[model samples]
Structures are given as C-alpha cells and as structure tokens.
Target: MNHNIIFQKIETVDLADVAAIEQQCYPNPWPIKTMQDCLDADYQCLKGLTELSPEIRCYAFMMIGHEEAHLLKITVHPAHRKKGLAQAMLHRLTLIARINHARKIWLEVRTSNDEAIRFYRRAGFEIKGKRRNYYRYKDHNGKQIKEDALVMCYSLI
Candidate 1:
C-alpha cells in the first residue's frame, strides 16, 4: 500500500491511464466513447494517483440523482490491488454523496466477482437484489455471452 497515494477528480489527463486499468479489470470494459460520455455530463468520477507516478492507479464513476447515487464502475489497477485504494475511493465517494443530499448509494457487481462482493460488503453495501444476465461476455470469436449481476446498495441515511 502506498501511503502517499492521492485521490482527485478524474480529468481528461487521467483517461488514458484509466482506460488501461479498465481494460485489465473487466472482461467487457467500457469503451472510450462511454468513458467520454461519463465525463461529459453531470456525473461524478474520481481518480487515484500515486505521488511518484503520473498514471492513475484507480478510478470510480458514479451518477447522482435526486436522493440516490449510482456507482457505475470502480476499478483498481492489478498491480495496485489489495492495497485499500478502492475502499478509500469509496469513502470519498460516500462523502460526496452525503454532501449532495443523497440518502443511499446503489451499484451492481458481477456474481462472479467475489473479491468485489467482499469489498462492497465491507464498505457497508448490502445485497438488495439480482439482475439476470446483466453483464455481457465475449468469446474469442467475438460472440456475446451473458452473466448475472448482483445488485448492492448502501444506505447513507
């Protein structure tokens, strides 16, 4: 764990680094256009960078509504995993949600991602429901497959 890591808003400069991490973190990572879309609107996104490096180590993308925030994605570089960066990012996001008058936060994680499930559970998110075949999978031949998604929610109020 790097004690000198800093968390900040995701800027255009951080997108390349984030894309690299996103590609490695998810089987069907968001495309550059989607990332741009997330950045172009009234959404909330944050990046984690190391004091010694110019690259982003982790990133979280969230959407805020009237009284709830949807955590769209959270990813940490494989090299920097298990170092508490994701938890730190989540903490910051929760604070931001609170300041925005949000009473709850929601997110969906893949049923196969046990590590993320544990992390979210430890971060105070509870399993609320499930979405069937909510995630897309691609075969070597570019065929699309589907997987179940687990819905998790965190109450801030």
Candidate 2:
C-alpha cells in the first residue's frame, strides 16, 4: 500500500477517468448513464488517484441511509491491482460511513469472483447470505446465464 496515494471525492470532473477505470475493471461495466446516475444519486461516491498523475485509479459507490450503508460498487483499474488500492478504498469507505452515522456496511459480489471474496474477507467483511441468480448475462450463444451473488456485510459498530 502506498500510504501517500491521494483519494478524492468523485466529482463531475472525474467522470471520464472513473469510467475508464470502470471499464477496465469489470466484465460488464456500468454505462455512462449509470455512472452519471450514481453521481446524481444520494450516495457518496469517491475516487482514488495517484499522487503524481492525479488520474483516477479506483472508484467506489456507496449509498448511506439511517445507520447503514450499501456499498454498490468498487473497482480498481486493472493496472493498479494488488497495490492495496481496493483496501484503501474500503478503509476510506468505512471511515466515511462512520462519520455519516452508519453502523454497518453491506455489499454483494459475484460468487465466482474468488479474488474479490478474498479481498473483502481480508478487509473484515463476512458472508451474510447468498443471492441466487443475482447476475444475469448473455453468453456467446445469446442465451442468458444466471450467476450467484454472495452477500457480505461488515459491522462498523
């Protein structure tokens, strides 16, 4: 982890950079409209940028409600993997949630995504439940395939 890396609120100015990272990180990345919706929504969104380049390296979208928050998404650029950017983002989200009076944080990840599961577990998130057929995607044959999702939660209490 580079302790000196800079993290900033996801402002409108950083959309293009954020979208680029999002596309690089996910198989089915959110569209520009979805990113815009997240920015316009009542959630707290953030971006992690390198100190030298000041380009978006990672981003997180979280919706805060009364004493709880749902971590909608967190993505790190493929080039920035294994550098603790995700951990830093999660840590920052915990702090932000605590400051916003959130007692717990929750999120869902694809069950087949072992790397992400390990990452969340290392960050203190525990498996809470499973969401069946949570991810639906069309295959090369144009048939929809359903994938399971693991629901994880972390207590900020």
Candidate 3:
C-alpha cells in the first residue's frame, strides 16, 4: 500500500470520479445509479484519494450479511496500476468486514482476470468455487457474452 493513499467513505459527490475509474478498469462498469443504490442499502462503499490531492484513484463496494461479507466491486485506475492502491482498498474492506463480525469475505472475479485472481490470492483469499455465467456483458462487437465468475473467500475466523 502506498503511504500517500487514503481511504474515505464514498459519498454521492464522489460517484462521478469513481465511475470514471470504473469505466476505465473493466469491460462493464457499474453505473452511478447502481453505486447509489448500494449506498442507499447501507453497503460499505469507499474511494481512495491521494493524501496530497483530492483525485479519486480507486474505489470499492462491499455488502455484509450475517457472518459474511461480499466484495461487490473493487477497482484501481489504470494509470495507478501496480502501485498497491488496489491492495490498500482491499485491506480496508477486509478490516471493515471483520469489524462487522464477518466470518469470511467473499468476492467473485472473472475467470479470465488472472491479474485480479493473483492479487486476491496474495491478499489471503482462496478460490472457493465457480459461478457459471455470473457476468453477462456485450463485447466490443456488440455480441452478448457470458463469463464464469470464480468465487473466492477470505476467512477471518
């Protein structure tokens, strides 16, 4: 984690910046509305900013249920890749989950996203199962595609 990075609870005013990073990080990004809905539902949403600057460089969303927490989304800006920003946000999320009494933290990653899988593993998450056709998106050619999601978990207990 970078010493200069700070994690802040995401607010409505931060959506545009987080959305921009989302658009840049994934093939299909969540709309600002979806993020708003998560907040409205009392999910934990956060944005990462540089201590010296207010720019949002990364963001994450997590939903906590009885004895578990699910990481709905976590993203780092492309330009900030390899700088430990993602890990910083992830660590913060893990702490929040633990504080909330989650026995484990779960996340689904696209099977093809080896980079993300590796990162999760390094952060103590284990591959638990596969969710078939969990993600549906249109490719660049406008053809709908379904991708399997690798369910991963990090146990706190």
Candidate 3 on 1-157: residue-level lDDT in tens?
6778888889999988888878778887888999999989989999888767898888889999999999998888888889999888888888899899999999999999999999999999999999999999987789999999999999998
Any runs in candidate 2 off by more than 4 Å, and if so which?
Answer: 139-143
TM-score of every prediction relative to native: 0.93, 0.92, 0.96
Residue clash pairs of candidate 1: none
Worst 10 residues of 2 by lDDT: 21-30
- Model 3 weakest 10-residue run by lDDT: 20-29
lDDT per residue as tens, model 1, 110-133? 999999999999989999999999
lDDT (Cα atoms) of all candidates against the true structure: 0.88, 0.86, 0.90
Give me the overall lDDT of model 1.
0.88
Instruction: Give lDDT for model 2.
Output: 0.86
The best candidate by TM-score is 3
The clash tally of candidate 2 reads 0
Off by over 4 Å in 1: 1-3
| Candidate scoring better on lDDT of 1 and 2 | 1
Deviating ranges (above 4 Å) for candidate 3: none
Cα error, residue 20 of model 1, in Å, equals 1.3
Alpha-carbon RMSD, each predicted model: 1.5, 1.6, 1.0
Query: Whose TM-score is higher: candidate 1's or candidate 3's?
Result: 3
29: Cα error in model 3, Å: 0.9
